[model samples]
Target chain A: MTSEIIIQAIVTGLMMGLIYALIAAGLSLIFGLMEIVNFAHGEHLMLSMFSSFWLWSLFGLDPLFSIPITILLLAFCGIITHYFLIRYILKAKMLIQICATFGLSIFIRSIAQLLWTPDFRNVDKPLLEGRIEIGSVFIGQPQLYASLVCLVAFFGLYWFVTKTETGLALQATAQDRHAAEILGIPSNKMFAIGWAIGLGCVGVAGGMMANYFFIFTDVGINFALFAFVAVALGGFGSIIGCLYAGIIIGLVESLGGLLIDPSFKLLYVFAIYLLVVIYKPQGLFGRY
Target chain B: MDSRLEFAKSEPIWNTNNRVFSIIAGLIILLFALPLFGMNSFYLHLFIMIFMHAVMAQSWNVIAGFSGQISLGHGAFFGIGAYATSFFYMEYGITPWISIFFGMFVSAIFAVLIGIPMLRLSGHYFAIATLLIGISFQVVFQRWDLVGAASGLWVTMTPEDSWFALQFHSSKVPYYYVFLVFFLITFFLVWLLSRSKLGYRLRAVRDDPQAALSLCINVSNYKIIAYVISAMIMAPMGSLFAQYILIIDPDRVFNIEISIIVLLITVLGGIGNVWGPIIGASILVPISEYSRIYLGGTGGAVDLIFYGLILMIICIFRPNGLISFIPKDILERKKQR
Candidate 1:
């Protein structure tokens, strides 16, 4: 492969990795706040893409402009999921907890299929529809914009969690729920807010992807798998770890696809995940 | 307080008392005699599906229920069983009976190879790792030309019922009886497991690995045992499914949906219980069949949506499963420790 093609692959991988990081960030945030793995997380991304697609198809608003709306819609969904489903399983057994979210995932995906047939849909002509040449390498404008937005969002979330009081309170609750409660922090509300923010990140990433990637009910499964890998690689509760891990996964996926078989790209990623999990069960940045 | 303690110690989940045993025995007898009624193909097919799913759920229960290691990639073992049996029969002209053993052996070996590294991680980590592994198997098998690739393998047709060939083109009744035998075998094995010391140790490992370790239990070894047994049990059923359906494909055999469906059945019936798979399959299979019959096609998702709702509701309200609703008095009887 030519150096230019390799560079192009790297750029593409980096952009895709940013989106993966943002999605993983949401998952990591929720895990940080509470030790629940949302098996339905991929469905949340599916919902976001659908949300953006519908907005564009019905109102003729570009995905770029529909970002805030998708974010709000997904955030609302997160809160609803939290209040209605998550709260009940908070103290359930591990198997039950896993099943609840898993059930929600199937439920959401089926509903999506019911409402919108499984045919792949895409934004016909979004505002950002082309590629930009940077010297000898080229990048899709949609991918570039999506990656930029995701990068900004990742930093923004990092800031909110670290510098803000509410974020600290959320962290406190995650660290020790009873202690945080004693300190007058409503851990319940923090959990709901955590879900909202967590899914909001998915919303942004999904909406951005709707510009280029196909919008479909099952689209989230693959992306969600990547996010899970990123979260596991980066460490479950570390935001920055997701960023680095996401990039690494992206590069590996693209380069592996370029160098080897594109079909086995997922296999390579899974291999890395298995290696990390076997050697460092705690993850590269995991506290537990 | 002493009586309550005794009651608590009683393993009521099995309900091994004479009355319950007689009732269960009668039910099995009835099932065995079902083919005598000359039921139509549809009912027979449903029964066959129920039996097959029950066996699958029971196998899963060996691991997730007893050992508390929820593997989301069980389809890999199932696919191995399917592929191995079908490949041997299709290519080498071997009987499925012999190939079935090959499938089980391969699955057991794969389980150990997978379980050693994966069983170290707990909870979501292990679950997702297995899930990814399952997906990768599908990807690999799809591209593998040796196994017929994406087009899958189709078993040769037979004009008449042939036990040797493990095919019944004339009627579904033979397949029903075949699957019933497998189900009963799996059921008996699980029943035996519940009474075994290995079962207790597995339960110990599941309930408290740290405590199990302190008690000198080989936690990882027990888990691997449970996992291997689970995989072994699952493989034969895959072989049977391939024989019965006369087709084996990567998508059908290796799909993650198979794993999830197995989970739902075991969870719905009752996890960690001998009869959980039976009860779960009895309820779930019918719902799936009827829904497919009536609410299929453009409304295809109705059943799945219903299943999803049922799963969530069960997880939220009846984490112990529908078996919990059988009345504690029936499931539990006063017994001396």
Candidate 2:
């Protein structure tokens, strides 16, 4: 392959990776706080994408303009999911917790199908149309904006979790719920906040992707699989690990698709995931 | 305390073991006689599906419930079994009866290869790895030209009915009886395993691997054994499914939904118990069948929603499964009286 083509692939892969990082950030945060892997997390992204698409189609609002609305909506959804469904099973068996989320995923997907139908929907005349050419390389406007938004969101989340007192409380709750409770952190409320932030990240990703990608009930599964790989590859609860792992996965997927058959791209991603899981279960940056 | 003492002192009206045996015998007799009553093909197909799902769920229970290894890629083994038998039949004109064993052996080998590396990861990591493994298998098979690629492979129909070929010309009765035998064998093996020394070791590993390791139990070995056995049992079911449907596809056999369905059935019934899968399949199959008939094209969505609700409700209200809700007091009272 030519150097230019490789560079192009890397750029495209990096853009895709940023969105994946956004989706996986929520999953990692939730896992860190409650030790519960949200199997239905992908569905939340799907719902947000649909939300963005509808806002664009019905009100002529650009997907870029609907980002804040989608984030808030998804954050509310995260809160409701935690309050009604997840809270009760917090102390249940591992299988129960996993199956509950898996069921929720099915429920959300089916509900979307029932309400909006399964036909692929896209934002018409998105604000970021066309591409920008820089010397020998060109980047799609939608992808560039999406990556920029994702980069900002990632840093914003990192700052919130590390700098703010509320963020420290969330971290403390994740580290030791009993100790945090003794310190008057209100573990339950912290958990709820974690869900909101985590899901809100996915909401941002969904809105951005809605500008460029097709929207459907099952679209989340396609992206969610990658997010799962990214999170697992990055270590379960490490935000920085998730970011780097997401990028690695995206590059592998894009380069593998170019080097090998496109159909085998997913195979390469899974191969890397399996290898990492077997050899480095703690991930590259994870302390545990 | 006084009531408990009095209960212990009471004489039993009947032998509990004998009564249980009689109930099972009566149920088996009923099952056998149903085909003779000229039931419709649709109900027969439904019962066959129930038996198939029950077997699949029970096999999953061995690894997930008994050994504490949550595998989300069991459908890969099932697909292996289906493809093994289908390919054997299509290419060498081998009968499914013999090729079913080939499928089982292949699945067992595959299980060992994957289980060794995968079982090293604990909890959610193992689950996610298995899920990806299952997906990768689907992707490879979809792109593979040897197995007819995405179009899938079909079992050629013989002109005349042949027992050796595992095909029937006229009725679904043969299929039901064949599946009944499959169900019985799987059920019997699970029952026997639950009461055996190996079962105790598996339970020990599942309950606490660290404790099991301290007690000198080879945790990984037992887990691999459970996984291989589960894969072997599931493989035949895939072969049976392919034969029943007369078609096999990467998506149909290797889909993540297949693995999820088995997981759901086992969880709904009560994991680790021998009878749990049967009870779960009995409840779930009918609901799905009826929903499909009543709801038509949107039936899939309705069923998906219904299953999701059931799973959530079960997780919250009855995490031990519906089987646990059975009144122990009633059985005890009948025996004591």
| Candidate number achieving the greatest TM-score relative to the actual structure | 1
CA-based DockQ, model 2? 0.67
Question: TM-scores of all models?
Answer: 0.97, 0.95
| Predictions in order: chain A TM-score | 0.99, 0.98
lDDT of 1 by residue, A188-239 (tens): 9999999999999999999999999999899999999999999999998988
| Residue B190 of model 2, lDDT score | 85
Point to the candidate with the largest DockQ. Answer: 1
lDDT of 2 by residue, B191-260 (tens): 7687566887898899889998998888888899999999999999999898888788999999987898
lDDT of 2: 0.88
Which residue pairs in candidate 2 have backbone atoms (N, alpha carbon, C) closer than 3 angstroms, thus clashing?
none
Question: Once model 1 is optimally superposed onto the true structure by TM-score, how far is the C-alpha of residue A255 displaced, in angstroms?
Answer: 0.7
Q: For model 2, what is the alpha-carbon lDDT of residue A76?
A: 98
Candidate 1 CA-lDDT value: 0.91
Runs with alpha carbons beyond 4 Å of true place in candidate 1: B1-15, B332-334
**lDDT of model 2 at position A195:** 92
Cα interface RMSD of each candidate = 1.1, 1.5
Candidate 1, B1-337: lDDT as tens digits: 2344344456555556768778878999999998898899999999999999999999999999999999888999889989987898878889999999999999999899888988877778878888898899999999999999999999877677888889888889889988998999888888878666788889889999999999899898899999999999999999999998888889999998899899999999999988888999999999999988888776548888988999999999999899988876565443543
